[model samples]
Target: MTKNNALGTNVIAQIGILVHDIEKTSQKYADFFGVEKPEWSLTDTLERAKTEFEGNPTDARAKLAFFDMGSLQLELIEPDQNPSTWRKHLDEHGEGPHHIAFFIEGMKEKIAIMESKQMPLLQKGEYTGGRYAYMDTFKDLKIIMELLENDN
Candidate 1:
């Protein structure tokens, strides 16, 4: 694990994998887990997400598939050709486990804390009732940490 801050490792809600092919990888995961492949979707144009990279706006897009793993979720991401943290990982390291996520209640507070800890924001996206951001944790834990918030 990485160095502990207020939001330690206990809040992690899911593990996200960077995949070269969402369909292929999802099928492989399904076969390995003895279940059907979960449906995947690209960023909806109408509901299209707005993203930021290293604090600057970006055209990042990705295909995503989610699977329920009881208390946690398993996410597979296949990034599009837009500049994104996911694309950077895929380009630099290829497909593999990219990040772990924490579904936080007050995402803004957590993001501020993470920033205070010097974990610069790598990517962020906003949707209808939720938003998510990836912070640089690779230097500490060899994986990124995603802060997620859903308005429920």
Candidate 2:
């Protein structure tokens, strides 16, 4: 890792986009790429996700679909009418790029480093085998940054 690299790695694992209709968007992407449309599914339940938003526990959820493209994955997010980072972005920005994710270790340290850089945590949640956090870096980077730490 470079001394100035707060995220530890320079590789971007995923680029997430917010959409009003994931089904339609996924289909369009599939057609454009000439690949079968991937299934879109809801995120884990609130109980399983243990989601927190703006430092408070939340039941926000969204449907997700992923398309693996070479070294990076394109993530589609269709948020429910709940208060979440995804929902907020979709509502405020009206469907577009949301975040760029990086797989990293030491999530806590990475969060702190980001916070120290004036990028506060916007949301966080746990998935089946890993956890993720969204950092509010849009002002500086033009997009949020998601940190994924998997426990394998």
Candidate 3:
């Protein structure tokens, strides 16, 4: 990889899609892929996740389903009626591909680099074993970029 590559790796770790009905959509995807339907679950509570949107704390949550596809994962998200990037995308753009994610280390540094390049942080949260940040890179890349840093 190039020395200037802010994300460190070029591999896409996951692709997230926003959907209105994760249950139906995930089932469809599972059938299409010939895999068992993955169980969908809600994100952690705001108290645990410490989720933020537009720089402020938020209670926004989503139902999430994941499918392992070789080197990458396919994520389906159905957001609650809250002010989050996921909800915003679903409202404005309708259900569709939302973001492509990269698993990386030094999340803070990577976020700083992306921000310096004009991609603002739209949302961020902590999961059970990791944290995630969504960068607004649509102006240049035509897609949101999700940075995932797992504490394994």
Candidate 4:
């Protein structure tokens, strides 16, 4: 198979963890990282979301904490009762690391390539400046891969 230019060159920019409680989990992460204060992730506040679950439009929310561990970020997500990837992970697998993310430039094209490869989109949502989606890559990678397209 020929390599497509859609995805471009990208790096694993962040690690996401699903948690039962963001406040409690963030503290643990802070302690583990030996930081007195951890920065609030961009998702800490609801940012006018447009979400999808299993290819259908849906609603979801989360409280998140972001830590800058050099070039990589560690994020903790506590999902609300709504149907979402985080909630589903918590229900099926309990609290733990959920996915690794890459920030992409040509997001629309990248998404098409991923779907063409049979890596179906499990969940997706739009935030302030851009959007994010999770690909169900468990059968191959045993973990989810998140693609993020941000305006800032």
Steric overlap count per candidate: 0, 0, 0, 0
Which residue pairs clash within candidate 4? Answer: none
Q: Which stretches of candidate 3 lie over 4 Å from their true place?
A: none
User: Which residue pairs show backbone clashes in model 3?
Assistant: none
Model 2 TM-score is: 0.98
Error of 4 at 130 (Å): 1.4
Candidates' C-alpha lDDT: 0.84, 0.95, 0.96, 0.81
C-alpha RMSD in Å of predicted model 2 compared with the true structure: 0.8
- Expressed as tens digits, the lDDT of each residue in 1-152 for candidate 2 is 68899888999999999999999999999999999999998888789999999999898999999999999999999999989999998888899899999999999999999999999999999998999999999999999999999997
Q: TM-score per candidate, in order?
A: 0.89, 0.98, 0.98, 0.87
Q: Which stretches of candidate 2 lie over 4 Å from their true place?
A: none
Worst 10 residues of 1 by lDDT: 42-51
Ranking, TM-score, top scorer first: 3, 2, 1, 4
Tell me the TM-score of model 4: 0.87
- Indicate the worst ten consecutive residues by lDDT in candidate 3: 1-10
Colliding residue pairs in candidate 1:
none
Better of 2 and 4 by TM-score: 2
Q: Which ten residues in a row have the lowest lDDT in candidate 4?
A: 39-48
Candidate 3 lDDT tens digits, 1-152: 99988899999999999999999999999889899999999999999999999999999999999999999999999999989999999999999999999999999999999999999999999999999999999999999999999997
